[model samples]
Target: MNIQPLFDYIRNHVTLTSEEETFLASKVSYRKYLKGQFVVQQGDVCKYESFVISGCTKTYYVDTEGQEHIVMFSVEEWWTADLGSFITQTPADYNIQCIENTELIMISSDDIEELYIKIPKLERFFRRVIERALAASQKRIIRSFSMSAKDRFLYFREKYPQIEQRIPQYMIASYLGITKEFLSKIKSQIILEQ
Candidate 1:
């Protein structure tokens, strides 16, 4: 795979020496997941931080009733992992699964730590990335609690138009904390009024 795009993405945020970029790239592994495959299951130790090169994934938790509640979705140029498990080296409380067949570049926690020792700037880069992720998650939580179903759907469409096209309706409904039927009604209402 051409790694230039990935390198450029990193370079834009962090100034990595040529040798550091080459070393970091060498440590990464390319992985592919089929639709419905679990990248990390509940109770499993999450070993890798993955960057999506293509396709989409959802991170969710199954409740006692076996209901899936989606926490977040990741599409191209996004990262997906159970950060609680990956950082703490504990078992994950959530499942991360591919919604579409996906290609990813992954680096193990161990390898990333090694990179940090060799190139300390990566630590700063990743810390900023984590901060952004936390902020985004906070915003999502506030929106889910504060917005109506129709408003949530509209917000999702405005923010992540690529996801609206690629993900199935039911999964999107779950992510929006609404029923599939309600989502259909929302869509129809918007179309008719437009």
Candidate 2:
């Protein structure tokens, strides 16, 4: 498989030398996950930061009622990790699971720190990534409080149109904090309007 897209993404974000690229690549390992498998589970320390190569994954939390609430979804080229737990070395409050059979490139937290030392630009790269993630999370929170369910659904479709075909309707409902029946109704309405 081509690592060029991933390399290009990093290069666009931060400058790196040939040696640094080789070093970083050496530090990363490829892994595959089957659907229904957990990459990192709740209460487990997140030891690695993973980049999706293919398929879909979701970060979610299980509530007391055993309901899963999706926090985010990662498709090809996206990164998925429990940032808080990874940095703090504490147990994760959420779980990252593969929504489909998936391939990922992962680097351990320690190795990532090593990467920063060897390739200083990577520190800048990750900082920007974190900034974007935080900003996106803030916007999502604002939208959750301000927008109607139908509006949120529409926005989700606009933002990640392929997600509709990849993720189950019930999971999408959970992600939007709506009931599956409500989502179905909204979908039907949207279809009729179209």
- Candidate 2 per-residue lDDT over residues 1-194, each given as its tens digit: 45665788797778778888888888888888999899999999999998888889999999999988999999988899999999898999999999999998898999999988988789889988889999999999999999999999999999999887899999999999999999999999999999
**What lDDT does each candidate get?**
0.90, 0.91
**Which digits, one per residue and each the tens of the lDDT, describe model 1 over residues 1-194?**
65665777788799888889889888898888999999999999999998888889999999999999998999887889999999988999999999999988888999999988988999898898899999999999999889999999999999999889998899999998888999999999999989
Enumerate residue pairs that collide in model 2: none
Query: Lowest summed-lDDT stretch of 10 residues in model 1?
Result: 1-10
Off by over 4 Å in 2: none
lDDT, candidate 2, at 189: 95
For residue 49, model 1's alpha carbon misses the true position, in angstroms, by 0.5
Clashing pairs in 1: none
List ranges where model 1 is wrong by over 4 Å. Answer: none
